[model samples]
Every structure is written in C-alpha cells, then in structure tokens.
Target: MSSFFAAIFLLGLCLANAIDFTTVYEWNKFDFVRPSGVDTSNGQIGQHFHQDQVYFQYMAVFGERLFLSLDSYSGIPATLVWLPTSGSSTVPPKLAPFPSWNLHMKDNCDTIQAAKGMEIDTDGRLWVLDQGSSKCSSKLWIFDLLNNDTTELVHQFPDSVVSHRYFKRELRDMVLDKTPEDYLAYITDSFSDKIVVYSRKMDKSWTVTTPGRKWNSLALSPDGEATQLYLARYFSNELYSVSVSELKNEGGRAAVKLVGEWFNIPCRMLIDSANVLYAAFKYQSYLSKWKNISEPFRDQRFYEVERLDAEQPFTFALDTNGTLWLTERNATGSEKRHKIIKAAVGARSYLFKPSTAMTAPQAYVSGGETSDDMKITQTPTVIVISLLVCCLFLCGSCQCVVNLVRMRRKQTSLRQISKDNREQRSALVPVNL
Candidate 1:
C-alpha cells in the first residue's frame, strides 16, 4: 500500500518535468552594466555631458551597446544612451566606443518630454515614439541618422488622440508595420487600450485601431512578412496579439487579425528567428483570479519566455543567434512594484473547467485555435492513455509510502528496546547525578 503512494509521487514529479520551463534574467536597476565617464555637472556615472538628467526608459540593444530613449518625466532633457556590453552581469565601467548622445527632440516643441517606443525602419531611419501631449510631446519624431538632424518632424499626431475620448489614441509606444507596402505603423495608445495603425510616409496618417493598454508593447518580424503586436491590458489582466499581414487587400486596408490573448499583463513582447516570443510583464497571474500588489515576486513578478506556438504569432527581427527584439512603453519602477499580471496558459485551463463567471462559450476560446476542435479531438483513447500513465504514477507513490511506513516501524521498535534497556539499567544503578 505504501509502495503505491511512493510510486505515484515519483511519477507526478517526472510528468511535471516533461514540460519545458523558461528562465528569466532580470536587471532591475541597470545592475547588468554601467556606462563610464563623469559629467562635470552632476558627477553621476552616466549623465548627459551637456546637462544633468535622469536617462531612463525602454531599452533596445542594437550593436554592443544598448540604446535607451532617455525619458526624463520631469521636463528633463530626453537623450539616448549607447552603453557598452561587457558580456558580464555587471556592465563595464565605460561608455560605448562613441559617447552617449542626448538626441533631444527639438523644434515645433515648447518643452522637453520623455519618449516611449522606438524602431529602425527598413531604410535604417530611427523612429521614436514620443508621447503626443504637453504631458510629453505631441508628435512621433523620426531622426534621420544619416542626415544628422533632430529638427525634422517626420510625423505628428494630434494631442486629442493621445488624450482620453478617442478610439485609438496615442499613449506612448509605436511600432512599424512595414508589410505589404503602405501599411505603415502600429502605435499603442495605452490610455485607451488600443493600437492605432498609421501610414509610414506623408505625415504618418492613421490606418486602423486594435486593442491595447498602458503597460502594453509590440515588435515587428525581420522577415518583413508579418507584424506581432503585444498588448498588456491591466484591467482584465489579459494579453492580446494583433497581426499585420504581408498579404494585401484591394481597399489598402492591411488584412488585420486580432490573434487573441497571448499572456497576462505582458509589458513587452519579442520574437526571434525561430518564432519564439519573449514576454516581459509586471506581474504573472497563474489563474483567472485577480492579483494585487502584496503578491510574492518570485511567484508573480519578472518576465517570461514563450514559444510562438500558433501558425502566426507576432513578428520580429531574428538575430544571428536567432533572438527577437521588442519595443515597449515606459516601465516605471512604481508600476513594476504595484501593477497586476495575467497568465499565458489561462485559455487552455478555462476550456477544461468552464468558469461559472464566464458568460459565453467563447470566453474559453482563444485566437486562431478554437476550443471545439480541441475538445472533439480529445477522445476516450486519449483519456485511457492518460489514466494508464496516472496508474504508473500511483504505483511509484505506493512504493515510497511503504518504505516510509517500514522505516517508521523500525524506528519505533528500536526506541522501545532502548527504553526497556534503560529501565533495567536504572534499576541496577544507585542514585547518581
């Protein structure tokens, strides 16, 4: 009987190991690496030589150095950091071969503001997603690195879109949907939980709108064949995907498809050449239940790695090592500490156990993959095979239990013998200290 329990326990652990797990490496406070040089102004490790400002925001690894859109929320000058990578956890105490430049978005702007997302276009032009508001900047600044000018405003969106009340307003982050030609860009309006697609050339005109939220982010594939957008909707703790097809339509509307939820509160999403999607979120929810701030970080915080398991997940550039890169909105430390999260595997679990709270059958459904087909395919034969495996697990568990029981009995008997011997010895001995 005990042996059966032991066998089952062993089998359960083995089965759990069958699934591949992902490891997440995090550098909370630029702990990974540091840039060298002292700005005579503030004397901080990495400061804009021209001025002292806090350079913090989303990062993009281009060459050996990581480029950050220096987002100083308090009207501090916005700049870009080109820090060298030392191949170590801690960054080398030096700047990149070239000095970190404060590519201040000047002209047509009254004050300085923080930038959100960024991208390098097909022609190698730098596209910066500036917050379209007095809150930030009311335009998406495209710096033509080749021309060496920041005064040019490649595209500008109205401030009203970035504000509340519009369908697909601009919050901060922007992505290029450079597919099928003339499809243009997909920008995330975090305030409205919507993604606004715009034309690349001719003033960056608006194209289409999709779902998204504050902490949401996106990326484009290197193949230039598709676009993979990641939305981290905090209210419902849902992660969503919007696709930009390489295929075209007659009306010039890129046949856009909402691929459904990808993960919970996904702060950022990246896709590699192998089609692996790496998602970074504020919190990781394992179930349908909502989570709060007090949740354990080990259980719910940090980023996760997931494979693009569907026919068409999001798209992105594939590096030499086959890694994907993504762009995201401003990830402030406060949000990282307090924001909520959702689960990537929530859809499948919901299908097995229909939630009474769910109003429709479609609630358990996912994008691209339908639950009905999965349900029908899971027949009696599959269940029988599962049962057989479970039985083997039980056998292993029972063996462990039996060993435990025998060991316990042996311990008890030995203690009893020792007690009897002590009693006899005490009777023969005189009282002593």
Candidate 2:
C-alpha cells in the first residue's frame, strides 16, 4: 500500500512537468523584389531591391495578418509589410504607396522612415509611430485597415505635435485610449525621459517629464474605472504608475510613484484584456508576467513563460486571442536568423473571469516550480483514489487476521470438549476400562 502511494506521487510529479512552447515561423533571410516596370530614376525602384540590407525591428498583429517594421537606422528605407499568419514561403508584399504621392517623393507624409513602436486600437485602426529620419519628420500615421487593399491614411499628427522638440525625442512605444469621452494617446520618449500625451478630440498635445523617472516602455491598465499609465525606465527594472489626469495637467509635473521592482530588466511590456502585465526582459531572452495589475508589485504574482537566446532586438506582440508572438530583430551585416515564434496562452475568455479575482498562472523553470501559485491546494484525484485503495487493502488484511484468530480459538475449545467427554465416558464405564 505504501509503495502504491509512492508511485502515485511520482506519476503526479511527472504530469506536472509537461509544458509546450512552440515556434510558429522561421526564415533564413528576408528578401523582397521591386515590381516589374517600376521607374528606377525616382529611386523608389531600388527601395526594396537590396533585401539583405533590411532588418526587422518591431511587429504588430491585426486579425490573421502580422505587420513588420524595419529599423532603417543605417540609411535603409524604412518599410512596412504584412503577411498571412499561415506562414509564407516568399517575401511579403509591401503596402502600396500612399494615394497622394510616390515613395520617392521627399518629406512625404505617407512614408515611414523608422517605426519603433505601433499598436492596433479597439476600433481596428493601426497607429504607427515613425521616429523620422533625415528626409522625414517625426509623426504619427493612422491608417484604416478595413478599407481597400492600399491602407488609406486617415489621419496624421499635426505640425504642432511634431515640433523641433519632437525631432530630438526618441519615441519608443505608444498606447491608445479610445474611450468615448476621452480619446488619449500616451507615448514614451526613451532619450529624453518624457511622456507625450495627445488628445484626438481637442487636437492638442502636452508633454510631461519627471526628474527621476526615465521612461522606456508604457502600458495602460486594463481597469476601465481609473486611467493609469504604467511605465518603466531604460535600464532600470523598476515599474512605476501615474494617473493620466495628472499627466495631462500642464500646470506641473505629475506625481509618479514606484509600483515595485520587477527584478528582471524589461525592454518592452504590454497589458492584456485581463489587466495582466507581460514584460520582455532586456537581453534575458525570457518573457514574464504579473497576473494582477491592481495589486502591489510585491504582492502580485509573477511567472516566466518563454525562454530564448540572448539576441538583440527582441520584440513581441499580443493578439486578440491572447496569444503572444515574439522574435529577435535581424541585425544588419550579420547572417540572417529570422524567425517568428508564438505561444497560445489559452483564449482570453478561458483565462479571464470578472467574477473571480484572477490569480497568477503557474510556471516551471528547469523542471522546478518557481512561484507561490505552485502550492497544492487539495490532494489530486489520483492520489485520493490511491489512498482509498490502500485503506481498503488494510481493512481486508485486518479482517483476515480476525478470522484466523477466531478459527484457532474454536479448534482449541473443541479439543478441550472432546477430552472432557472421553473422561466422563470412562467414569460411566467400569473403572479401568
């Protein structure tokens, strides 16, 4: 019985060790050719002819399509292309030139020089963050993806927002708030440690800078009641939060409070619909998450989900279905190591429930559980069954022992009765018979 219980425990431990992390897409190189008969004199013809010079920096997902943006910091033309998630054997088709002008045109509002960060809002509009280049000015481009094959540029940030200061700013990542009453956009400037807030309705912008907080990444809280902005610094692993109302006030610098130290240095982070915060560690090649946003960072649960090599330009995107897609940035002048990896973290509906307070997901590292979530709440069903079987076996063994004792006593009593009967018969018969 003890051996049976030991076997059951071993089986349970083996079952807990199984987890799957899958790689969905990989490529040895990225190549794109200019369409036939395109004019070469304008210089737009050679834009994508030299595919070896291009490298991927950022990515965003909309529906079944994945959008990639090139780094172009080294004189390559910044490019954007979308391909089906079903994996393609060839280079993705480039989005057509903006309707008003050709790609070769200088200072064109339609072109993207360097896109470091982009996000898809709830309204299905894709907001692109262009850091600008020698030819282009720093600007925000909004496109309606639901429109024709050529994504139409619906709106552009005004010159007032993209001023001289913007040119000096190194915009990293952005989050959109499409609330009916307040349409706000929060952008982080890693170089200057500033947060830029823009209002769509008023068409005005404001900048907020803190003395100690050096902003690197920003994520909006999933809670709809309080508008909170969570941001991290360039090299610091600490997380901080501030209210949007305070940040928008032009009166003074908003009060920024430290949420807690994340311990792992984070490069980028995103908040899911469940209000869970997922952060990609800088050069650590692993993704970790905080299950609860409202709770204090120390009290909240953290789990590490995926692990990869220490590669430059690591980035990730979360899809509508709660799947995380990640890849390392391709480096210029280096052998291509292009790959897109994805992990299905179950659907949002299954993972999130409004009634129940969401707890952190369980994760194992090197075959050992890492967080408090791994604590066993109740005995497993298999272990319970094994215990019941052992109890039944013990009961049967006790019953057999009782029966054997009863039989031994019965035989001894019968022997005594036979001796008494023989003695009495001998007395009834003649004395010495």
Candidate 3:
C-alpha cells in the first residue's frame, strides 16, 4: 500500500512538471519592431539605442496583451512597452511602446519618464509609475486595456510627495488598495523611503514615511477597509504591516507594526485574492508562500533549473486567466538571458477580490453568485426573502405554490450567476505548493 501511494505521488509530480512553465517565451535580448523597419543605429532620431542597457523592471498581463515596464533613462528608449501574447510562432516577439511611441519621448512632461513599477487592476486597467528623471516630472499613468487602450487618468506627482531630486529618486514598487467605494494606489519610493498614496476620486496623493530605507516591495490584503499593507525592504530580515485606514489619515501618521521575521529577505511580494502571500527571495531560485502570518512558511519549487542562481523570480503577477506570470533575471554575465515564465496558480490578484464584506445570501444554491458589483446588501436580500415567503403563504393550491417557488429560485440563481460573472471565472483547482 505504501509503495502504491509513493507511485501516485511521483506521478502527480511528473504531471505538474509537464504542465507547469511550458516556456511561453525565451528571448536572447529584447528588441523592438521599428516602424517601416527604420534602423536608429547611429544615434539617429536623438534616442540612442542599446539592446543590452534596457531591462524589464515589472510586468502585468491583461487580456491578450503582456505589458512590461522597463528601466529607462537617457540610454533606454522606452520605459513602458508591451508584447502580444497570442501568436503561434516560437520566435520571441519584439517589445512595442505601450499606448504609443510618442508617449515615451524624453523630456516631455506628458510622456512617461521612468516607468519602473506597474500594476494591472481587476478592472483591466494598467497603472504605471513614471519615476521622474532628468528634469522630467514624476507621474502616474493609467490606461484602459479593455477599451481600446484609452487614456484613463494621469496624475503627476508633486515635488513634495515624490521628491524634487527626481533624477536620484526611484519609485521601487506599486500596489493598489481597491475597495468598492474607492480606488487607491500605494507606491514606494526607495531613495526617500516613503510610500506615496494616490486616490482616484480626489485626484490627490499623499506621502507616508517608514523606518526603513530602500523599501523594495509592497503587498496589500483584500480585506476591504480592514486591509493590511505588507512591507519589505532591501536586505532587511524583518517584515512590517500597517492598516490601509491608518495610512489614509489626513495627517498621514500611522503606526507600522512588525509582522514577523523572515529567513530570507523577500525582494518582491504578491498577495492573491485567496489571501495567500507569495514572495520571491533575494538570493533564492524558488518562491515561498505563507498561508497566514502564523502559518508555517513553505518554499514552492514550481520551476526547477540546473543553476539555482540563473532562474530567481524577481517579480510576480496573477491574471484573470488563473495563470501566474513572473520574470526571472539572470544578471550573471553577458550571455545570461531574462525569461518570462508562467504557471497555472489558480488564483487572482488582491485587486479582483472583494475588499468589503457583503451581507447578502451567499451561494445557497451550488453555483449561485451575486451581481457584477457584488452590491447585494442585507436589507434587500431580507426583503426579497420575506416577499417570497409571503407569496408561498398566500398561494393556496399545491401546483401554484410549487410553480412559484421554482420560478423564484431560478430567477435568483440567474441574478447571482450574472453578479459574479465578471470577477470569479478563474480555475479553482489548487496546485501543490
């Protein structure tokens, strides 16, 4: 019996290895398709090009487009770019500037200066942080990926929030505190050690300072107003947390509590809709996850490679398609190549989950769900239930009562299914961590 069980476990591992990380793209070096095949080789067009200088800082997948945020300066041409994910050819596709090439032009106050960090929300919107450089002002750019790549909103950062020394400053990471009532963005500035909070409704941003410098990563819980913001710093073993409500105070004064200590310093972190916290360690090849703050931390070896140093996942993002996409940087030598790998993680990002609790009738029927907004409240649900009860009580004939109950149940099921249709379509099968 024990031998049979061992064989079954081995078979499971074999199956996982087969389906996980079916190499989406393996690029030797990044390239962009120039319009009309124009070669800007000899410092042409005033934007000097070097394929080696540009590197991907962040990536987010929405629908058919895979967006990449690159580290840009005077040497790099575009800070924000994208590549099409749907293609049959095995050749690596070239990166194209997102929105347009004009938006990436240098020194333009309206153009993206340094898109170092980015996040794609559940609403299919791309939120990017343009870390200002060389006199170009810092700004946040949001583009609607679902609606023909429309310009959604642009909120330029003030010197007071990001810093007047924009050239030296860097926005390390970005995360969203998306609730039903409000949409907020929390961005980390490494040079000043502050988290800049931006609000969509007010079109205003505020700054919050913490104890650590070189604040590298930030993760937000999906607990609505009760959400907890996780913080990690470069070369720091201790992790910290602060409530989102505290950070939103008018005075911008909040007490950041130490969550716990880590065995390895986490360089990047992600929290999914399932409340699972996943992290990529600085010097480790494998990613780790924590069920909760108190649960035992486990290292997940989803991707295996011969050289542990070659394939350390630097950044991670979960899409609505139930796939987890991440970028691995092998900055060892001249020949080392960066890779974009993915696995079926069966989870969604924190942005897609319900931030606030809805006190409505949860799926009493098997696959029942709420409306699109999940706006089902307690009072309305109660009133609806009461009306149904009265209808049954008033109906005298058995046939009439049966018919009405069936009709009402069917209607409720349809309403619930449509309610949850937009957000909860990902595969729910749990993979071994």
In Å, residue 126's CA in model 2 sits off its true spot by: 0.3
Cα lDDT of model 1 by residue, 332-360, tens digit? 33322111111122121110112211221
> How high is the lDDT of residue 4 in model 1?
50
Supply candidate 2's per-residue lDDT for 158. 44
Per-residue CA lDDT of model 2 for 194-242, tens digit only, reads 6777776776666777776768887887635576888887778888899
Q: TM-score of predicted model 1?
A: 0.48
lDDT of 1: 0.41
| Prediction 2 global C-alpha lDDT | 0.61
**Two-way TM-score contest, 1 vs 3, winner:** 3
What stretches of model 2 exceed 4 Å from their correct place?
1-19, 37-39, 45-54, 88-110, 149-167, 298-313, 329-334, 347-433
What lDDT score goes with residue 254 in model 1?
32
Worst 10 residues of 1 by lDDT: 337-346
Alpha-carbon shift of residue 325 in model 1 (angstroms): 7.8
Prediction 2 TM-score vs. true: 0.68
Ten contiguous residues minimizing lDDT sum, candidate 3: 363-372
Q: How far out, in Å, is residue 249 in model 3?
A: 0.8
